[model samples]
Target chain A: MEKRFLAIGWVLSVLLLMGSLSGCGNIEPWVKPYERDRLADPIMALDGDPVSTSYLQHVYEAREGARGGEGAAGGGCGCN
Target chain B: MAAKARPVAAAAATSGRGLTMMLRYGLGLLALLMAFSTARASVLPEDRADVLYHLYTGGGVDIDGPSILVRKQVGKSVSVVGNYYVDMVSSASIDVITTASPYTEERTQWSLGMDYLRGNTTLRVGYTSSEESDYDADTYNFSVSQDMFGGLTTLTLSYALGDDLVRKADDPTFQRDLDKQNYGIGLTQILTKNLIATLNFETGTDEGYLNNPYRSVRYFNPSDTSGRGYSFEGELYPNTRTSNAVGVRARYFLPYRAAIEGEYRFFTDTWDIDSHTASITYIHPWRDYTFTGKFRYHDQTGAHFYSDLFPSAQATNFRGRDKELSELTSYTFRLKASYAFLNESQSWGFLKKGSVTASVDWLFVDYHEFSDLTANALIGEEPLYSLDAAVFQLFFSFWY
Candidate 1:
């Protein structure tokens, strides 16, 4: 199983490296002042920077123990 | 790199324009030049990077491998970030296997992302892909954030689409795959100079097979044991889980360049799980650097269907399941520190501004069961157990 996993990882790494290199030449710096401001609007935070660590800890406990499916599903058990 | 070219286009100007029109054109040209010059002057630093690692020992064993991340600014409004992570886990904490042995699980994840800044707004887009020993996942995500009221208020929107595939250990015919989509919206308000509050909502939808081939539940009827006994097989959960959270944090600056921050989170999911977490950090500045310490606490409860025992096989409602119901609870603690130095500077003997940080964290897990399922055929009924683990992380970031 370990050998198989290593083989798969090596193949995928090669593929990803090739793909990234191919895009290097075409990767343009897209900068639009108005659009950039629109993007920064606070309504969509990825994980809420300042308080994210504690929040993630809370969610992890919910999915593993006290909470059920009120949030996203877990990899195995959905117990809360 | 042919796709990297974006030339500034010249504006159309009338050859025989009025003096006012000519003056307006001249001012527009000057504004355009200023914007270009600002872009040229802003450069992304080459030395910014981060690393994180974690481990959990005791009843619920988890050992996360070393993970690394690096970020580089490519242009005025563009920066690129890359990351890689690996983790290996053991299954002895759950008490399912007969031996005191452990099953091995591994996962690898990587991603590349771009962040763009314009005035008071920032836009970020990225693609990440991950592969487990037997599962695969790929995600494409994008988000936009803006600062309002002179940085007092912030808002963001994000979306992601992903694909998941799960393969069972022994069953060739039992394969599960799902298409998943997630969306999030958040808002942060600065109630005062020292207080901040944030509210966020996230929703996800998944469609396809959802069943664990190696998991089971006990039977209610004694007759249903049939010696082959109480574990349910091949059942899938079809409900969607939605979550909403509200949080508040405050920071107070003290004398001698010291500050304290406290934060709390209230979260709930559709599966009936509600949780609360709180943490505090203290930062103190020394001669040329700062040191920080953190502490946190968390708690959670069990779902409605959790059960500790199964009935006799003769009972009519004999479901022969063991897992759909088990109570769970846990706690965690962490400590970390960082130091910075001046590696390169324009002036005197002060260290030239480069920083390196290293930290260590320890965690523990305790689990209990209420049923005879513990002493079942595959695994002898055993009491609760505790899992313990520790992790180390190191990182460096610099500005030129």
Candidate 2:
């Protein structure tokens, strides 16, 4: 099981590296920056309320056996 | 039956003086790490403040607290945030009532963080500390994020270190040390104008004094007759543990300005515990009110050393009866509402927007292996234990 998890981690790393390398090329973004109004909508925020989200995640961690990988952005991130 | 089998048994001498304290804050360390996963674009954080009240009641346990958070930008390149959180717990749950007496405990935690933005890159550093009567923890973290593909994708890398001091309430001289480390990576991709997705992976490790000081394992003793048929011995656990989790989430905008989000996570640890969790949420906004609903499910396999009842005294090299380590399935249903009391058209001085949000989550869990000792049934015929809990949260947020 440890080997399997390690292999999976490696695969994810490779995917990230490959995706990042693709950004090195002269490829054009499929979604133009100006067309991101919908994505920028407050309702569409993946981690909108950092305070509330992290608090609730804290509650779950107290009771559940599982932890982490919740994908909360941050209490403070350089995002305006 | 398990509790009636043995009333007071202590193996605390194995490790030292037997001192017992609740571990309500032991898990807060993980929250600190998850709070700053740090996946943001090449923009500065918005200035905001939040005041929140939370309550959780279920299975004869009551937890209530208040949380305050504030964030502000300094100049054009730096942003700072701080959070103060508390948890007041009164527990008479099945474990307490069955093994020992009821107790009340309080935990307080505080965190400080800073973010710096430079061109298309962002850097963050943070520190968090939590304290209780029997436990104290301090953590330091750092993260970096970059925007690529013309702002279509954001990737973040983070690491954190936690230092913990564990002590026993009854034994003033009893103290132990625990160290933890966490590593994480996250990616956010804008798939389309109306769709966005994120993937996150985290790995963590812990060493030294991993088990609960007060919690005990049940072992059958035919020679004893007391409150229960068994005896309680201090739980023994492996000193080191490693865990990994991967989660994926996607959000899509509806045709009519509504939104739907789905998420899934898989977790595994060296203790042989594996879990799968999933959730789906829908948000609908009508004028000043936004209504949201969600459903979440989680299922997990038991740890290798956990058992509801051991056959005899000192039956296993390591023993534990912590319900959280048992095979179980849980479900949660959430209802939330947020009111935009002040929007662009209605701003108040320095505030850009303000909202009040309230939410309640109903949780249910079924333990596949753990039994309801209060049932007083025969040993093997004991019925499975179940739990129902209600979690409530109310908060006000303002962005300036």
Candidate 3:
């Protein structure tokens, strides 16, 4: 299982590197000021409600064995 | 009709004037340039406050709480944030009923953070502390983010450390300590005018006592002279654990004022547990209101030393009966709606850009290897355990 995980990690790293390189090109045009209204909307934010997301993360962490990659570290609880 | 025609003719005559047209075009260009310049400059966060209420119900456990968070811009390039949270939990689960009596507890948490911005880089640091009757924890975190490619790309790195103290409520002197550390990296890119993507990787390590002090493991007694019997013993677990996770998220906006988002995550740990998660969300905006629907699926493999029952003759140094360590799968569905009640142009007294949001989620979980101890079946013949849970939240936010 460790070997398999290492193989997957390598593959993902390669793919991400390739994508970043390709993205460095000038193939896409810049968005205009008038066209930014939609992007500036609150719904377009990565985390619109920080308080609610924090609660969700806490519940999941207590119930599941896996954690991290979402946000900052938080206080621990004795739910289990 | 005559008045409209006269106005149209006058506009046509004005267009025929070349100098007037040139002056108008030049002024328009200047205004556009000014807008662009202002958009490129760094902007400070507005002073805002959020009040949230949350409720959770499942598997004979109930939790309800309220949280408040406030952010204030201290200066041109500095911001401060503070949070206070509380959780009131009441539990009467099968485990508690069989081993101990039902109980109610209250947990409180406090956090403070600061952010500093300079040029294209931002630095953030935070501290959090939580206290309950039998547990106390403190965590410190720091992160830095840098923007590149003319604000098209962002890279972030973060680290956190936690110190926790766990104690048995009945045994006053019985206390244990644990330490946790985490490291993470993230990258975000604007793939196109209507698409954005992010990739994140995190690794965490835990050392010292990591198991609940009150949990017990069931063992079959073979040497019983009268009949086959069962004995319960305290659970034991390994002292060290390490885990890693990688995730990718993407969002794309449709042409008709709607957006779609997708996320996938892979997780693995030293305990031989592997898991996968996939989720998708759709968001639609109409006037000043936004509505969202989301679905998530998660599946995981059991740890190496987890079991429902163990033979009395076979004793191992590391044994666990926690259902969370067993093979399991879960599905969650969520619906959310938010409305912007006030805008900057129409402020409510001293507050601006007020919004209210409400969300609800339903979750179902099935355990593959763990049995329901509350079942009528004998010993190891108990039925599999499954659970249904619900979560609800309502929040109000305002900026000044």
Candidate 4:
């Protein structure tokens, strides 16, 4: 099982690297300033509410065996 | 001839005065343009603050708390943030009631952070500290993000280190220490004008005294003249553990100004535990209100050392009876709504850009291979355990 996990990790790493390299050229569309209203909306933010996200993150960390990869790690508890 | 010369002189004087007036008007226009440019250049992002109240109840536990966060931009390229969070927890779970009386405890956590941006790169550093009746922890974190492809893609790298001190509230001499570290990398890309995707990988390590000192393991007894029974002993665990997780998330905007989001995560650990999580969310916007619905599913396999009951003769060096280490599956459903009461660029009194949000979540968990120890002790037969929980949150945010 450990070996299989390692293999999957390697594959994912390679795929990410390849994708990044292949898109080296400027393939992205030009976004005009006036067309950025949607992007600037609060809903487009990765985390719209910082305090709520922090509380939820702490709850999940205390309940589950898995953690991290979502965002910055802060705060600790003695839930167990 | 004299009269003609006088008329020519007057005409020359009139032309000269008109030229002077034009120069004065040009200078005045230039000054106004300079002032407008300066005002535009000096305008910085607004400072924001948030207050949230959270309540949780279920599974013989109740938690309620409030948190506050504030962020301020120091200049065009620097920002600072601070937060304070508190949790008041009361538990009467099976394990707690079986071993000891029900108890209530409080935990407080505070954090401060700074961010710096230059060109297409951003740097962040943060510190956190938390305190409880029997535990204290401190953590430090740093991260860097760089934008590529003219802001179409962003790459991030982050690291965190934590030191924790654990002690028994009743025993002053009992003390233990733990260390934890995590390393992570992430990539976010805009696939199309209406689609965005993100991928993240994280690896973490924990060392020194990873088990809860208060928890105990149960072992079946065979030699007793009395009926078959179980004995409780202090639990033991490995000293070090390493874990890894990979996650992928994507969002697509609909033609009607709505959005759909999906996420999946895979996790593995050195303790031979594996887990998977999948979730979906839909967000809809009205005139001044936005509503969201989300659902999540999670499943996990038991750790190698975890067991409901162990035979005395078959006991190993490491024993674990913690329910979190047991095979389990869970589901979560959530609904949220937010209203932008004040979204105009102009400020009202001392506040600007305000929103109020409220959300509710329901969670259900089922343990597959683990049984209720309390029930087993009473009836001599174990029954499967399940839990139902609910969470509520209300948030208010405003910018200045």
> What is the CA-based DockQ of model 4?
0.13
What are the runs in model 2 whose C-alpha is more than 4 Å off? Answer: A1-25, A73-80, B1-41
Cα lDDT tens digits, model 2, B75-179, are: 989999999988888888898888888788888889899999876667899988888888888888887766765677676777777887778777899899877
> How far off is residue B260 in model 4, in Å?
0.8
User: Which segments of model 3 are wrong by more than 4 Å?
Assistant: A1-35, A72-80, B1-46, B222-228
- Interface RMSD against the true structure, candidate 2: 8.4
Which stretches of candidate 1 lie above 4 Å from their native place?
Answer: A1-80, B1-47, B52-56, B60-62, B95-101, B191-197, B220-236, B287-290, B310-327, B341-353, B366-386, B398-400
Recovered share of real interface contacts in candidate 4 = 0.20
Sorted into a CAPRI-style docking class, model 3 comes out as incorrect
lDDT of 3 by residue, B218-237 (tens): 77886555343666677788
Clashing pairs in 3: none
Sort order, TM-score high to low: 2, 3, 4, 1
RMSD, candidate 1, Å: 17.6
Off by over 4 Å in 4: A1-36, A72-80, B1-46, B222-228, B376-380
State the DockQ, from 0 to 1, for candidate 2.
0.33
> Candidate 1 chain B TM?
0.71
By lDDT rank, best first, the candidates go: 2, 3, 4, 1
In order, the TM-score of chain B in each prediction is: 0.71, 0.89, 0.87, 0.86
Q: What is the C-alpha RMSD of each candidate to the true structure, in Å?
A: 17.6, 8.3, 17.3, 21.3
Best by TM-score: 2
Instruction: Quote the positional error of residue B93 for candidate 1 in Å.
Output: 2.7
